[model samples]
Target: MTKPVAIKRRIGRPPKEDSVETSNRIIDTAAQLFAAQGYAATSMEQVASACNAGKDTIYRRFPSKADLFGAVVDRLRAGVLENLENEINTIADSGDALERLRHLAKWFLSVNLRPEMVAFKRIAMSEAVVFGSAGQGQTDKDPIMDRLVGVVEDAQRDGLLCGDNSTVIANHLIHSIVFGPSNHAMLGGKQYDDPAIRDQYFDQAWKLFLHGAGQ
Candidate 1:
């Protein structure tokens, strides 16, 4: 009679795989839609539809549209940040200050000029202009900019560059190297579409940067 004993199955939090999979799908779909439609026009419902997910799914993961958009922006920048850190490590053995910065600058432009990044930047900048910040998990400090400043400071210590403020020096170099190409690409300018032309532009910019900031 003591033959059968019933065991209760554990009911707890679900496996992380499902949550992660859904999160990635939502983010990827939102990125494409926001990039294609502009942030103002893209809606959560559209994102959910693209993800083949319910609206509740998005709301559960991200509290609001701003939150979801911020997630998209964060993920894009995070990926580039990781790659840029790798680029920094890859060039750590280089002895020339300007040359080291040159490698970093090239990597920066190549990654940021990707169509998806350009779209995200355009939207994020628009958000910042109106809201004073790209709210919800965004910080005013640019980690890449901080790392750029570090490189410039190291160059200054080596007397490879001259500047009263290495921060300003680094800022000038980055803006010169990135702003024109980034702005043009964001506006759909076709001039830098070819890698050859892009490299030519970068080389010319690097030379000019050296002339102005190198010692």
Candidate 2:
């Protein structure tokens, strides 16, 4: 009978560490490429090249281009929510709901006006046209919406507003506030660089949204 031999295990690079770093690199590269080239035009090969990895490496992290695009969208959405949360927490007094709303709106517009945000929005719009109504659900439940809902709920509870459904009201308010500014940028108009212009726009949105809901 052959003698039984113990198998020896070899130590190598940790799989977990490699996975984490590779995923991050893929996400970063995808975001940059998608923003610069638009979602439909960017390819896995380009992303892999940008990250100095193989196409198989990107595929290991994201099964398809659509999946990678979704990841990029998620990152941008998270950033918007973080900025909104920071702005909302800075509100010292509950009675200053109008002021708080103005600040939040202005900050939100500033974020939306960023080059990366503009590029992302344009890509999304283009993709929506190609994908039709079916694409709508893909954009649902953004973190920024959740943060805005929380802020609206707090205002209502503080007796600063009278909205019964804070989530719906928050959606409407944010949509109205951002629509004009985003459209203007999308049209290639001069950037709203003047602080006064931003303030005026936010003030109007604040007045309009609060006038209907204020106690």
Candidate 3:
């Protein structure tokens, strides 16, 4: 008669609270890597190593490098949108549409000038139009831009803005306050760390646009 031996499998310990910290570290490492090196150049292994995590851990959280990069982009986008929304909501006591618009422009500049945002925009622009069609047909209608448009529409209804097309005005305002400055800095190899510069640009842009649209 032959005797069979049974082997017991060992169970792994549950992940600790530091699991979330590790995940965030991986994400942050990926963001920096992707920003320093283009998305096509950055690798999941590098991200894992940078985060002091295992390859399997990265795969467990994000299936692929592309997936992880997409998540990073999404986080940056959502953060910018949330900051802008909070700024807009704070305009409740501005007393007039023009002041609110000024506040909006200032807030827009403040948010856009952040290094993370600038890096995200740089990454998006480097793809040279591929990023434009990655989502819905409306390429220009991101959550943050949509919220800004809503604000512009409200301002128009309140007679703070005068234009046959509110959407067009909103686009122009966003381009001027957000994309224009960021693009300029990115193209010129300039750092946008100084709040004073942002405030100055915001003031000038807001005043010019308000003057043109004011009654």
Tell me how many clashing residue pairs each candidate has: 0, 0, 0
- Give the TM-score (vs. native) of candidate 3: 0.77
Off by over 4 Å in 2: 1-14, 92-98, 129-140, 212-215
**How high is each candidate's TM-score?**
0.86, 0.79, 0.77
Better of 1 and 3 by TM-score: 1
TM-score of model number 1: 0.86
Cα lDDT tens digits, model 1, 83-116, are 8788889889876876787788887788778888
- Sorting all predicted structures by TM-score, with the top scorer first, yields 1, 2, 3
Native-referenced Cα lDDT, model 3: 0.74
Off by over 4 Å in 1: 1-13, 126-137, 213-215
Q: Candidates' lDDT values, in order?
A: 0.83, 0.75, 0.74
Identify the candidate with maximal TM-score: 1
Q: What digit string (tens of lDDT, one per residue) describes model 3 on residues 121-190?
A: 7777886454443332445446776777777777888887888887788778877667778787777556
Question: Considering every candidate listed, which one attains the maximal lDDT?
Answer: 1
- In model 3, where do residues sit more than 4 Å from their true spots? 1-22, 129-141, 191-197, 212-215
User: Which residue pairs overlap in candidate 3's backbone?
Assistant: none
TM-score of 2: 0.79
In model 3, state the lDDT of residue 197.
72
